[model samples]
Target chain A: MIPVCKEIRKEILKISNASGHGHIPTCFSIVEIMYAVYSNMKHYPKNPLWEERDVFLLSKGHAALGHYCTLAKLGYFDIKRVYSFGSFMSDFGCHADRFKVPGIEASTGSLGHGIGLAVGMALAFKLKKTDRRVFVVIGDGESNEGTIWEAVMVATNVGLDNLTIIYDNNMSHGRGLQIRNPAERFRAFSCEVVEVDGHDIDALGPEIAKRGNKVRVVVANTVKGYGCKTFVQDQYAWHRRSPNDSELEMLLRELDEETI
Target chain B: MDLSLHDERIVMILGDVSVYLFKDFNDKYPNRLFNMGICENTLISVVAGLSSQGLVPFVHTIAPFVTERSFEQIKLDMCYNKFGGNIVSCGASFDYAWDGATHHCYTDLAILRLLPGIEVIQPGSYKELDVLLRSQYDNGNTTYFRLSDHPHEIDLPVQFGKGAVIKDIGAEITVMTAGPLLGNVLEACRDLPVNLIYFHTIKPIDRELVARYSRTKILVIHDAFGLYEAICEVPNLRVSYHGLSDEFCGWYGAVHDIRRKLGLDPKSLKEFIKNTIEKTGS
Candidate 1:
């Protein structure tokens, strides 16, 4: 799982370097969370739209490079296809588009939309009496949207225990204001909040697996740029900036040396 | 009711409005109905999600909130993603006139028409609303149904993508419109020697009918903005438009009073049509 995360990060960097456009740090921060969820979740890559498959939505749609790489690694498509991330011929855009991509559950780029989409899917699953669960990965910056809280209230009120939310608490917001105490806020919404180290798969795997009668929120505390040394502990500038030539070489070298 | 009864996958979602109107609907299918409070953005995105799951979701709210407040969601989630859902909006134009500009929607048709593959329908009466709703649901496309309080007793059968000739006496001038403004246009042209055409579906604009009446002068009297430009695609048609102008109505009054102030009332529309006919010498 750790090696897969490293590989996904490498692929994301390659796509960003080729396209000269992507949310690199944002995608890097969520690689482990994506790896943990994809490794443990029930999904058939060949049959992407299988009815009984558990749903995964990247609410923070800017981190689409990470999602594309993860889906490619899971054998949903060829990894080579993702290299055309920003090109007109490519199905993958900077933001995830569901119609073009097979494994993407929903088209998301605008903030505060994915939570409601997940809630609706979760409600449908409950109505159909299916045991399938829905996992949505949302950014902490995206949490500032009021619609997210509206979905949270409804999910808790409806007792959608089959729905799980993984908040990428990278402590970096777009407008330079960090969301203070997201776990307490989730608790206020009556969600069973579970705090975990976002980069550590051992801590994230078990927390994501836990399900009960209430909506569960796993707050994964992580750094803005997880693996790369240039922007690892940096703030908002690295959110979407592409790496220069030397920076790209340095990132690839760092990934090679890091013992997962 | 017939559509929902036949297809159990059809669900209705509300945005803290239209509960009284949907009481009977909720009583019949309680599980299929959901009230998502006042969150219009969530209402649209949730409907998109439900549509993705192969369920036909019909979302209802006031016009401005559903179409304007959540415009991005409707564009990206529903239209861009090509998800099929029905957005049924009430309080169109100035129906909720006393509630001020916040509740009224005058540009929804123009905004939604720009979205690819979305069918925009504005029913002039209860009969048209029922027929258009059922037709769009059966087609299972991304459609927007504009509902209003005006009820016109017309004999024309409501078709999905076609226009109805309300009073076609082959006159020199043709007046086209949709929604509640159809009633005003009909009353305004009752004594005039002109032809009247009402459109239940706005987006497609019934191009054939527009081309048929293109040799003569045409006047479009509508409550919403941009209908004239949308329907005037025919080159030969000498078109003059009378609808809500670019100015915002920030005051409060009855819908008719507001329409009169905006030069859309029956009296103003009649005078405008007479002036147009006299100027064209048709």
Candidate 2:
């Protein structure tokens, strides 16, 4: 693991341990994808609302801790403030609120929502005749919502080449609504498709950068918990469970020992 | 949209509802108008995305599908995210009454007004829609413009959040209505011993004007659900609703059939108002 993304995973662990909230396993699944998107997308951490900047939305909002950590590491805000995640009156909540956070484009908690916002934004760029693009990260589980496919269909039909959707294929949907071949489905919907390993930033970054002829989709195959063995092996148990002191230490040790 | 000429940010996204109506729109502003298919949810979501980029978008379609089916999209993407746009819905309430109950839309204004950071307008006239749409479209909040095919010819003052009092005679009874139903409502209360009030805006429900008639027994008469519920928001007012029973409007022919059946026609309204005046001994 790269040091920054590892550091993000550690930060997510520490915050969720301290805050007693968050879908930590889900957050871990998208660490590298989140890092890859931020590192590759054209955005200013200091000037978040800069008119000419490209927009990124974390559509599967349960992984917001990962998104907040990604933005903080990218210098959007101080990492120290994120320890208050899910606390009362805290800007950083379980789901990202665009008004509260600097880089968050839209407040999303409900599945199938943020992708639609991303579609609208991509269409806006097309209408405005701007080179600015939109990036959105949706979860495998969130695909069960019909609105996700609805958005993808619109993005494809409108030929929004500027919109790049990153599907965090963490198989969280395997327990429920299964999308067996997401890439084929996306291709059937007429999107430019690329399959990538979610944890490998080297593989993810280029896909994030590649703008295609139609709506581009990067279906990133990822583990539900990439860094820690305990969460990965027993994902459903730790899906929404925060760690105690001992578990946090064990997870930290497991993360430090991770070689991938 | 005349705003389309000067303000290049105004993009109209339709849900395959009124595509032919905007043939001129497509011709005049080629790239600005998009018939964004039959997906209502996607249209609102896309409009939010467009608004996030400082672009003003108008997502128009049939009232129920766009407003009811895509209610979550509007609540989460547009209102909650504070992405400003214009949501112009045609076929208000029973405007598509011939298309049956699924095509009917009366809960739009009522349900939409419940969402925070939204402006709900049921414009009764073309002048009202034109004036109010121009006035409020760029204000940077989710503003819903419910348009009707059966617009009244009444030329009332058009404002974004204020109410228009047509008749404020100091009678003990007051009749409040909104949107195109004002034509029937006005004729119903024309020679009655009561005051009549009309509104284009619903959310910031003109609390002061509504409160002004608090001393009177307010009769909320309309063709739909929202105006009655909105009037009930004002405190200490003896308000009673005279529209929309708690069952589906099962039968359908035209908007007129539904209106007459629901007792929203001028004759029924007139008789109801006269009876209210008699019952209360006003």
Candidate 3:
């Protein structure tokens, strides 16, 4: 799992570097969470739109590089398609487009929309009497949106036990805004809240699998730019900027030396 | 009736604004209906989700809240993602006149028409509304039905993407209008030598019909914004527009008074049409 995370991070960096634009820090923060989901969730890569498949939606859609790389690695499409990240007339835009890309459940880039979309899907699954789970990964800053709380209330009121929300609590947003306590905020909306180390696969895997009769929110605490040497500690500088040549070389060197 | 009887996949979601209007629907299918409490933005996204799962979801609310407040959700989650849902918005233009500018939606058509692949409908009569609702339900696309409370008595069959000729007397001047304002337009052009045309489907706008009237003088009157402007986009047509300007109305009064003030009443429209005919020398 660690090696796969490393490879996904490498692919994300490559795409961002090549495009010269992306939300690298945001993508880096949620790499492990996404990796855990793709590895553990029941999905068919060949038949991306299979009805009985578990769905994953990136609510914080600007961090689309992470999802695109993960879907490519999962054999949903050719890995070479990631090279057309920001090219003109390319399917892979900076944001996730469900119509263009296979394995994308919903097209999300605007914040606070994914949770409500997932709730609707969960309601559909419940109505259809299916056991398919809907997983949504949202950014902490994205949680500041009122639509998220609206979805939270609906999810709780409807008792969507099949729905799970994994919040990437990266602690920093654009313009250096910090979320004080994301788990407590989610718990106020009447959901089973669990805190876990976002980078720890051993801890995250079990937490994500735990489900009960109510909606569950797993707040995964993480850092912005998890693996990069210069960006790991910096709060907001690397949120949208791509690395230059020297910085890319340094990031690659740091990733090589880090023990998995 | 066909929507509730035949199609079991149809689910109605409300934004706490249309419960009284849908009481009979609620009584029949209580389990299928959901009142999502005044959160317009969340209502749109949830409908998109339901649509994604192959169920036809219809959302009802006031015009401005659904179109303007939740504009991003309608654009991204519904239309951009190609999820099919029906947005049934009541209170077209200043129908909620005394409720002030917050409730009055003058630009719902304009904002929704900008999005690609979304069918916008404005039914002028209860008969047109009935046919349009069933047709849009069967068609299954991202459609916006701008509903008005003022139902006019018309005898035209409701067809999607086709303009209905309410009164065609072989005149050289054509007057096109939509929504409940069709009643006022009909009264205004009753004595004038002009053909009356009505449009319920605004987005897949019947461009062919508009072009067919290019040789004649065209006068378009709408209650809401941008339908006339969109029709005028048909190249090289001699068109004159009569509707609300691209400005907010801070005046609060009855619907009739507001219409008179905006020069949208029947008498005002009659004067405008007479002037237009004389100017065009048709």
* DockQ per candidate, 2 decimals: 0.74, 0.87, 0.88
Model 3, global lDDT: 0.86
Give the distance in Å from residue A47's predicted Cα in candidate 3 to where it truly belongs: 1.9
**Ranking, DockQ, top scorer first:** 3, 2, 1
Off by over 4 Å in 3: A174-177
C-alpha lDDT score of every prediction, in listed order: 0.86, 0.90, 0.86
Model 2 TM-score, all chains together:
0.97
lDDT of 3 by residue, A1-260 (tens): 38888898888887788889788878888889988887778899999988789999999999998899888888999868878897899999999788799999898988999999999999888877889999999888898788988998988887899999999988765445566777787788889999999998888988888777889999998887887766776646776888777778777777777622
Point out where model 2 deviates above 4 Å: none
| Winner of 1 and 3 under DockQ | 3
Candidate No. with top DockQ? 3
The candidate, 1 or 2, that scores higher on TM-score is 2
The reply for model 1, stretches above 4 Å from the true place, is: none
**DockQ of candidate model 3:** 0.88
- lDDT value, residue A149 of candidate 1: 92
Give the winner by TM-score.
Answer: 2
Each candidate structure's count of clashing pairs: 0, 2, 0
Give per-residue CA lDDT, model 1, range A1-260, as digits (tens): 38888899888888888888889888888999988888778899999988779999999998999899989998999989998888897898988888789889988988888888899888878767789999999999999888899899888977899999999998777466567899999999999999999999999999998887799999999877788766765545776788777878888888777622
The alpha-carbon RMSD values of the candidates against the true structure, listed in the order shown, are 1.9, 1.4, 2.0
